[model samples]
Target: MHKQRLVIAGSGSTYTMGMMMSLIEEKENFPLKEVVFYDIDEQRQERNAKATEILFKERYPELESFSYTTNKEIAFKDADFVFVQIRTGGLPMREKDEQISLKHGVVGQETCGPGGMAYGLRSIKDMIELVNDIRTYAPHAWILNYTNPAAIVAVALKQEFPDDHRLLNICDMPIAIMISYAKMLNIDVWEIVPEYFGLNHFGWFTKIYDKSGNDHTERLKSRIIDEGFTPEDTEIANDVSWQKTFEQARQMLMDFPEYLPNTYLQYYLYPDQMVEKEDPERTRARQVIEGRQNRVHSLCDGIIEKGTAKDADLHVDIHGVFMVKAAASLAYNLNERFIVITENNGIISNLPEDAMVEVPALLTANGPKPFAIGEIPTFYKGLIEGQYAYEKLVTEAYFENSYQKLVQALTLNRTVISPDKAKAILEDMMEANASYWPELN
Candidate 1:
């Protein structure tokens, strides 16, 4: 197998260090010839790149070249795989996305309600631009995107590049949740083969089976209901809001026991509860900035100051592990099974074929080969269809610059079902995102 040249598009992200650690762990399977960090923010990416360069020197010195740059052509030229995790407006803009929605008496989340809609609009423009740049710079490179508001971004990209098989949009939330389930079941996460379906964050795990083919879906569901739930990541447990999100998954399961619900569904399934619990003064974005953002950068700063990464404390968690594993599957043709967001195309018999739905897929050299989920029940179908409509409308709204379509999108979102509330939130969002979003007519 030919060695690969990998580029991290959002090298400045807090998750960058973790991703590097994962790459190191999977080096045997996915060998690297070079690594490049690309970001629009020079200072931020430099911080991560400088630290990563030291770590690479100490840990995996086999790499022939390592560099970071703000230039797209320099970062992407001849890359075999591009791992994208860019944040269009950064954490400050995300804070506004949440704060504005909360001020309007609706659920405020990073990727689920009005906040997601706002983030989605801004993300589509940059993501489309990034894709085009990749095509120009490295036409044969596989683009594995981990950008948030992925459902909306996926739909926008699908509409923009329908036949492009090199791009794969994925989320690690399912993997995160499965890690927790593995802990609950007292087994390694890899031992569990899961069957899942739905939109990005708004999905469900229909079944989980051990390698021996023993069904543990009901057993794990019972455990969650009996003992409550929490993510496997200790950092997430430190946040009160994330704790509530995991706990709410138990409640969602009790109310509808058909399948285990994704924790993000808490925003849509119980909007009022989420809204009431949210502190307008401090949202998840603020917590992340105060917590993970600070910790990752501080660690990098320490490594830089010491001029060595011998004592660096960067931990490899689900985010990094999931990304590298997904990339390696494609790079080495490992055919690893992962849950990815891809074009539906009759995967779900009831949903629109063009909708980008999340389902189990075999990550091969060709791209994600999604499993056929046949037909979901009416309850799941209805919820997925409504969310799909919202995603489609958001995509349409961005391309057409139609304020009315955005209003419809938000109105259809479960968190902001009322047109009055959607418009109120939309007006505030429009003002807050004036500099980022396109001028909506």
Candidate 2:
């Protein structure tokens, strides 16, 4: 077999960088011939690049490693697979994302709301560059993107470059949430059979079963209701589930009859709109960025600060073991249904076929095979349609300059921000993320 090439975008992110570092602990890494770190900023990638090289040399000497410039041809040359976890902008802009949302009174966070849409805009250009690079240098390479606003990014990519087949978009939320569930049931996440669907941070828990055909969701829900969360559960949430699930669960249980929803938005941001007059920290994003973010990013930073380049080889999957198994299942999964993003194609009864909806699907080497969604409750239809509109608008904004599209994204977000406040926050984000998102300006 030929050697495998993995190109990891967003090498600067501590989690992405840490995941690379953890690769050393992997079992000989599946015949990796080379690994490439691609980032727009040299300063950002250098730390991770040097750290990884040191780790690889010390722990996995046989594995080859190289860091690439953002140059498309040079970076993507002959890649076999691409692992992309781009933020487009760095943490500082993320702070602005949350702050802006709070001014409008919507819960503010990195990848939800007008702020998330803002983050989405800043990222599209860089993502487009990566997409274009694949077309140029590694057309056959499979691109597994774990970028925020996964739905938005995926929609933009599929719309702009309709011909690309090597694209697979994913969010770590579902996998991470499953891990949270697995611990409650005293099993590894991979051992659990689950059915779930929704857009990235905005999805649902449809079904869950264990090796013995046990529906564990009710069990998991009861445990969490009683116990709140465990060490492992909190670890995954603080580190990588984004801020969506945990924060949302408490209210979901209180506000509706639905299963306590996932954490995609629970702990994210709770304000409706952002305003300069309010205490900056009062905004959910600011509270997170100023107060909670370091708690999260520091996990990876600690590993980097403590380790030499040689230590990079030992980076372990501290909170992401679930993904390893999910990835594995694509090749040999026992036909389990997963909530994956796929074209509706009438797979979701009553939903538009051309639209991408999250629904139960079979995972195989052939790709995600979505099953029928059957009839949804009327309430769900309206909610889903609203979210669908947001995704479409964001995707449209990327493809063309339509203020109308941006409006739709905000209206559906419905985090309790007034339309006027939403527009204000949107404008602030457009200005703050100006460098990262040229099209919006």
| Cα shift from native, residue 409, model 2 (Å) | 2.9
Off by over 4 Å in 1: none
Pairs that collide in candidate 1 are none
Candidate 1 matches the true fold with a TM-score of: 0.98
lDDT of 1 at 339: 96
TM-score of each: 0.98, 0.84
Q: Best TM-score goes to which candidate?
A: 1
Write candidate 1's Cα lDDT for 46-133 as tens digits: 9999999999998899989999999999988999999999999999999999999999899888998999999999999999999999
lDDT of 2 by residue, 1-441 (tens): 345676777776656544654455553424467888888777767766766665666666777666656666777888876778877666667777776666666666666677678878877777887788776888777777778777778778778777765577766566666766787788976677776655566666776788788887777766776766533544344533233335446456555546545565452233432232335455444454554445434543554687654322333454333333334445344455555666667775776666767666676666777777676667666666777778788878777866666876787676633567657766777778666664652
Alpha-carbon local distance difference test for all models: 0.91, 0.64
Residue 222 displacement (Å), model 1:
1.3
